[model samples]
Target: MDIPSGDTARKRISESTIHRLSRYFRTLSLLEKENFETVSSKELAKREKLTPAQVRKDLSFFGSFGTRGLGYPVAELKAKVSRILGIDRIWRVALVGVGNIGSAMVSYKEFIKQGFHIVKLFDNDQRKIGSNHKGIIVSDIKNLRTELQDDRIEMVIVAVPATVAQYIVDDIVKAEVKAILNFAPINLKVPSGVHVRNENMVMELEYLSFAMVNHHSPKGGGKA
Candidate 1:
């Protein structure tokens, strides 16, 4: 594959762009399921509430995907997007906590079905460490490094307590993991080049409540 120029590479693709690409792929999959053959960028953008120019630019980053007159083929575009995002390959994931949220995630069938396989689960609690969840045994946190290396886990899910978030991240960095999805409600300081995605449930719920309260307020005129 021809690499993009430095200028193109330096043109940082925002998180929103990546997310939209995934969304586009999902939409295309649905269209394919409905027997739709091709889709114009303008049509896709309208359905997704995005600008056609934005759609074109995002897809252009990969390569010329559409002809001047015709639009992108649904199946081809879906395959290209999946390949670009590295979703075509299975990604090994390791979970660092076996608490309620972590256990639920471990038992969630969606992750495994979506190409992210949880090869190892870890926890500090002795009783829980040796137990099994969804056919995967919870291992001791002390063995994180060894298990990570053995399982070739590239991505990690940090569900440890907030107090130990930083400590766990540090250990994860030392384990040479590339990407992390953090559920702990703490700002973690990771070394450069490592990706950390924080999923803060409390913050999301608070934001939702704020939106609801403001929407119903007299000052806001109950817009709905």
Candidate 2:
């Protein structure tokens, strides 16, 4: 992957671009597991349901990884994308709210495999404060700032209710966390330097339902 020189003026890449890169990485990893060595842009695009031009354009931003005709080595491309996404190194993550969603995240193996470790769990509830799951002792939310600073946790996942999500995020920011992945179904305002990504499962499911309904509409396959 091409690393831009200090003298090169770089423009901010879009989130969609990064999402596509992640897809490419995942697809490449699968292919690598199947013992594939190299793949062409056309083949990669076909696997991703993208145009060859689109795949090429997305990769071009990071520098050329593919040969003129032979294509990209699967292992090399996967590592490059992982590096670009900042997942090549282990990142200590703090989880706020050990409820259903938060607990699920705690047991999620993908995050750990992808180099994100949930080192701390927090909640304001007294009942949950001392609870333990997979060796993670739930701590009081009041200790978040000190624990984050002490542990040097740079990222946090906010799986709290919408009402208190922003408050938790504020505490995360005060602890100098750099990134957040929020599962609460609400918008949050954060400092300029902090990045927050909201994941709304309900919104996604609603959109999927709309698409399914449209697919079965009268003009398509549904009964009049």
Best by TM-score: 2
For each candidate, give its TM-score against the true structure: 0.88, 0.91
Local accuracy of candidate 1 as per-residue lDDT tens digits, 44-67: 998787789989999987789997
RMSD of each: 4.2, 4.6
For model 2, name the residue pairs that clash.
none
Candidate 2 overall lDDT versus native? 0.88
Cα misplacement distance, residue 32 of candidate 1 (Å): 1.6
- Runs with alpha carbons beyond 4 Å of true place in candidate 1: 1-10, 216-224
Instruction: Please give, for residues 90-184, the per-residue lDDT of candidate 2 as tens digits.
Output: 99998999999999999999999888999999999999998997899999999888999999998999999999988888888899998999999
Error of 1 at 78 (Å): 0.4
Cα deviation at 168, candidate 2, in Å, is 1.2
Model 2 scores a TM of 0.91
Q: Once superposed on the true structure, which residue ranges of model 2 sit more than 4 Å away at CA?
A: 1-7, 213-224
